[model samples]
Target: MPQMFRHRGFTGRIRRNYPMKKILKWTGIGVLAFAIVIIAALLIIPMFVDIQDYKPRLETMVSEKTGRDFAIGGDLELSLFPWAGISFSDLRLGNPPGYREKIFLSIESFDVRVKLLPLISKDIQVKRFVIEGPHLVLEKSSDGKGNWEEFGERREPEKKTATETQQEPRADMLPVKTLQVEECAIKNGTVAWIDDAAGTRNTLSELNLDLQNVSLDKPVDISLSANLDGRPLSMKGFLGPVGEKPGTGPLAFDLALSALDQLNLTVKGKVTDAATAPRFDAAFDLSPFSPRKLLDSFSVPFPVKTADPGVLNKIAAKGSITGSTEKISVNNGRLNMDDSAISFTVDAGEFQKPVLSFNMEVDSIDLDRYMPPPAEEAEAASKPKKKPDPEAGIDYGPLRKPVINGTVQIKNLTFSEARVSDLSIKISAKGGRYNIEPIELAAYEGTLKAGAILNVQKDTPSASAELNIMGMKINPLLQDVIDKDFLDGTLKAQMSIAFTGDEPNAIKKTLGGSGELLFEDGAVVGIDMAGMVRNVTASFGLSDKPGEKPRTDFSELIAPFTIKNGVVNTSGTTMKSPLLRLVVTGNANLVTETLDMRVEPKVVGTLKGQGDTKERSGLAVPILISGTFSEPKFKPDLKGIVTQGLKLPKTEDLKKALPGGDEIQKESLKDSAKDLLKGLPLKKK
Candidate 1:
């Protein structure tokens, strides 16, 4: 029993101290020593390497890749620790030989760091990349050649024999599958662009960029800040994973941009085939922006001034865009400018010479805010300036743009003192000719329908319009359009007018058209024809008293007029009242705003009838109205009144009223008969 126990203990001890355990322990010690030695070598090797000796090779490699001369003016640095990295200082690359600029790109310092663990797996994982103080110059020569274009000679691959081509295995040129950058930063960058042909030079400075988690498998956050033409700009965005095939992958993104404190924009979307033929559905928001401030920040001048300084300040828009490289469409677009709100859709075709179609509706817009101030207008008018020739200062340049087809509808529109509601206009243009047809509006208690054609293809642009105004109040309509209230009534009118000029004054001077005006239960406000007749007769010692206060109230007034060379002529204008009738013949010069009219007034016998009477008891007077439309002079023709007042009595009245007139008349008649008979018979004898 004692011997068996001793043998079992011996076997157990042997089993405890096995050969595999000893081998594994020694192998671990060797691996530790080797790792230490390797680490020590990595730390010491850079000290003796003298990286400057490799400068020529590095420069040559860069030059070959870029097709330009490259140099490292300062030292090259290397570090070996948790990661390996190489850094360069004072590096410059020269432009193509013939370019006017000496250097294409220059960097004060550049650094790249790679994780050591990834190197074992043949995967390049950059820990950090930094570039400081880089300046790039881009130039375009007078001959339209750009400095960045490829200028180096290319070597074509030698053609392979058919047998060799079959023998070669198909393989990708670059086999690296995984690439990642954890962080990247660029600071104090500058870019300059020169266009010799255009004689323009532009520079951007103080540029900075920062990136985090830059990889193909996760979202990358990026931030950029720059100074563009003295304006500060900033952007922040996140881009979705780029995937294995970077350009063709679907991407989701969100970006925000701010410029000079004047504009702010945000865009969020998903894009497919991001880098080539990208198709995207995106939502964009731009708000709290000022167009005027943007222009001012860029040192650009504004062409017009508004009455309210804030009128163009608060512009905002929200919309969705769907597009590819060749086409883009904006849908559900909502815009707000000051007090106006507009919704629209725009489809643009043919990206080069874009054909645009738009449909828009505005809730309300007060155009008066965008017009010149009244004080400025009055001051301009008060200045002593030469009368301008209207035809000399007109420009038709805006008509030469690409075609535009659109429809615009406005619920309410206000201009100066005029208010219009429910206004709609259809517009189309092609080849310098534009048509604004089916323009309908509700204004001044009536409806106005008009269409206009403007042909700017000629040296002098020609405009034609046809208008129909129905059941309009003449007083307010005239006051709004022409600042005159010459008549008051409900009016129905139609006009077809045309003019050949681009300037307002020239068009007025060249106006030619014909129209008819019909006013019912209206009155001429400025002067009374009946009052003038009565006053003239009473003054000439022929009538009782002047008629009532200087207004001619008529039950109906009708005038059919023709316009020629800016002059409006009416041959027969008739006005009928309860107690009087008037006929007016006149010519009004629209350009000069002058009136030359003759008014003949007659008193009617019956108060409630529409027939002419030959009663001679009432006075007849002819009045002359001449002067400007604003201030006209009404005068009676005294010679005509006196001639009319000295008329003889009728033949019957004279014969009946005379004393012994019957006997004298019989004797005179007998003598006249005898004389006539004797003359006829005596000629025969």
Candidate 2:
């Protein structure tokens, strides 16, 4: 019974297996037949079908659809075997009616090959794509319409409602699942742009572009070279090793660019969520190059003529930059120019009411090198001064909107024949108020500490400053600044000043300040005090400073001053020297640049050290100084000599009446009498 049951089960299995095998065989046969028929159709259609015969209908259809004349001047070839491809020559597209040049675009030849099977998966794999000897023209008519304007109809774009715009992305967010190209190239393409109204014509010619390893999953190498308006330009780059979902994830790029063979640059970057909310981080490096040479390559003049021809040569920079829709940051930034280098970082955002911040450090720089060379003496003298333009005035409204903060430190800086060391500056601004705080620098054996504020909240801006200088050498400072060294001393000074308005002349007229200046162990060059004292009437003026450059040596000089409404007043400025004592009082008119001063001088017969305050034993000659600062006049106060209490007191009365009546005081009085009478041609009583 067991053997019989086994036999039946085996038969049952065979029965089921036979039908399954037969069904599989029939399915295979049907698939092979379909494939064979497709292959045959692909091979036979091109051979038997004369696609050119339908060119007129095809051209007519295209012309009607595109609203432009289209034609194929040469035979069209088609292939469908390993690569589905088409090749044609002498294709032309015409512009709309009324154009002088009817042909808008023309091509010598175009060929393309694409894999057909990939289309089923919504993917494109381009086997080969090539274009050769294509030409295009963009012409602007007198009415300002271009040949490339709207093709078939002037239809406004369909505007979506707010709700529609905010809708979720459709399933077909991307045009294709993936794109891959084995090779693509364009050669000898040209484009011409003509503007009839402007009477200008420009052309881009000899354009070549090539791409390799082009795939969504792999980096694509691209290169292009072209000539633009007779200037050469080239670009080579690699884009993407993109994520599986292109435009949703990271994409990387590296590019090198050059123009006129003079400027060379490289850029590397990455972008995330490129399609939705793109964020990018990039690095840019500029190779050492001459900016002057770059401009010259394009037959453009350098912006300014510099004192040193080589100043702007050899500049290089590298920086890392990152940006989003609302924010931008630059880090690891470095700039190199010849021997100078700077490191910096910057951040900016909120452009509507702009906010900007930066920190920078520079090793050394010479600004004078970049300044324009001095004009010729004769040319400068002959050039007419420009009249003030009433319309050219400051618009401080823009300053009121933005907020800015910055700090800069320079180890060494040189400009205008002056050198500074260890300079640091901090600045901030908001709502039309600007502040510069802790501005410190060292120059000419001196250190300066200063701060300033500018308020433009109102129509007329106002400014104020506080500055202090410590132990600075005046001779070298003046020599470097004005090429003059009429004063030699170590100076200490402090000032606080304020003014309104931005114009220099207006500011000077409105300036108000208080300051004190002290000079130690110095000489007033070009002045002779002893000669003035000896012959007061013969040379009453004593030239204040003779052209021969005689000088008066002083141990200490002090001046304290105040300014109001553009006038400076100094009530007591004192100078002590071995042979003279001088006191000066003056009001200097800053608006008119004039001086009104009184100087009292005393010649000492028995000189005392600067520290001693012995009685005055000398002839006093009061003098007046008046004129503009540029050409001051000095004269003795003859009226004062005739007026104030010079009625001679008897020698006994002078001794008893003077304060203290000390023996030294009495002797000084007697010596004054003897000297005045003996020195002058007067007889002694």
Candidate 3:
């Protein structure tokens, strides 16, 4: 028994102690079962594994479907596990005839969900989506072809059931609710619609748009805040399909945008069809907005200074418009600038419509503040020759006193006040030139109308005007035409005065016209013709009125006169006095500031034939009225008569010099001695 135990010991002991054979067999079976279960789970559960180069496959698919080249240039990645999401960095899409771009799309992350339960129920559902850094360039030629519509030939009509047509189709291959974004930005994006048939194109900018709560059946809400052509625009709005409407695609929500310190408002009207243009209703409230302020904010024609912030803040307006994408109409509006307020009722056609109608009124304004600035020659000379700055002259732009409140009717018009009357006025300028049409001015009670043209050039000043007086009151009308003094009688005449010059003095120098002067007892201030000729008689001389002082030699003078330039002539008039025929000629020198006149009279009646010796023994007066207009010098003709009077002897001494008389020397000596003694001062004793 001992020998037998020793030989069989090794095998039996191994089997009993360790159980090696059974352990090895069970271990192999367990490993094989685990491998089988894992392989089955991978295949049957539809496990998705992400591939880094996945974008190529998508590009290939899109290229085939659309018959156009599609490419993702840079990195392409795919996510696995929870949801299958694909991302393509730097992607580019191409339509051969229309568009191409560079540095396309970069999708940082995304997800995809497969619905097992829905799949079993034959329902299609998407569970995931993602987006990051995508940029697109959409362009079209001026002829009207575009990349979006480039594949028109390759597209086929979609076939669907009546029920599907009536209702929005459930999202297939896309999630019902999608939230996608992470520092998602788009650079240099563009959308252009070109109609080759019409040869028209409209291009809109492309920038980052934050999309949120995107659903197939609900409104599409988006927020856009970006710069367009250097102008910042911040807008938020929503647009979506209406409730089961056949033709209506979507209705737009109110859109609010803020810029230039002013809120610009917009609203979408009812949507009709895809074939129709997008219609909108909008309102621009300029009442709270100033054009000057807006210009300042944008830095366009940028402000030169801001010493007084309110200097450029005068205008305010309120208006509303409604129309299609291409045209708009304004209903009612009003504007206020400075002291003037204008109200308008307008009926405008399309934006492109050429004909428009408007009625406006000017409530009142201060003319002095808005008058054109005084011209400066030095300021004009300092400007550059090629593109010289404008003259620092009067600025009528603000219309400080624009009394334009009246019904203004215009079809296709050019109007001015000078043309309304016989007096013509012209308005012109270097940068601005316009000839006004005949317009009826309703500011005053009468049916007043006038037209004019003004030419205010930087280098030259010119003007012309024509004023017509209609049926108006004769008295007040004259005041506006002529000066305060001249003729007090009522005037009813058609008078026209024309001027051609820049300055007031120049204009007056060039004035020329002729008109009748009708009068009812018009009086000449200094003379009374009837009283002078009739009352003056030789017998008992002239009789004075009761309690009146005797008439002086100058007081009984009478004359008639006519004026031309600054000279006065009295050649064609009758006057009665101690003197006879009288003729006066004078020239007034305004430049030298002097007035000179010469008077010559022929003695008449008792003094007429006194001695036909032709010896001068009468008044030869030279009147001088010289000085500035404000303070003129007036006195008798002293130089002409007083100096000559001192040269005349008291009497002729022919008798004393006669040979038959007592010694002339003796007589003369005696008289002279007596006169000398009388003229000399007496001694105190």
Model 2 scores worst on lDDT over the 10 consecutive residues at: 676-685
lDDT of each: 0.78, 0.81, 0.43
For model 3, state the Cα shift of residue 155 in Å. 18
Q: How do the residues 1-685 of candidate 1 rate in per-residue lDDT, one tens digit apiece?
A: 7888899999888898897799899999999999999888888989878888989998999988888989999989887866899998999999987778999999999999998766877687898899999999999999999998885766799999999998775332233457789779999999999999988887889999999878778888989999887788899999887666666768889999998878799999989886657799999999768788788877777667778666887799999999888778999999998788999999887666567789999999989889887788878877886777755765666565658799999999988668899999999987788999999999888889999999988778898999898888877866775566457788888889999976556887889999888888887764544443443333122223235434568888888888988899999888887667878898988788777988777776554444545442345556666766655544455555567773433445334223344665444333321221122111210
Better of 1 and 2 by TM-score: 2
Give the per-residue lDDT of model 3 (tens digit) for 463-546: 444444343433333334332222222222333334444444455445443333222223222222223222211111122333
TM-score of every model? 0.69, 0.79, 0.40
Model 1 vs. true fold: TM: 0.69
Pairs with backbone N, CA or C atoms under 3 Å apart (clashes), candidate 2: none
Candidates 1 and 2 compared: the better one by lDDT is 2
lDDT of 2: 0.81
In what order do the candidates fall by lDDT, top score first?
Answer: 2, 1, 3
Give the residue spans of candidate 3 off by over 4 A: 1-74, 78-86, 90-208, 212-218, 226-233, 240-250, 260-274, 283-287, 290-317, 325-327, 336-340, 345-353, 365-438, 442-447, 451-466, 470-685
Clashes in predicted model 2 = 0
- Candidate 2: where are CA atoms >4 Å away? 1-107, 134-156, 161-178, 190-205, 226-237, 258-261, 376-393, 537-548, 602-605, 609-618, 646-685
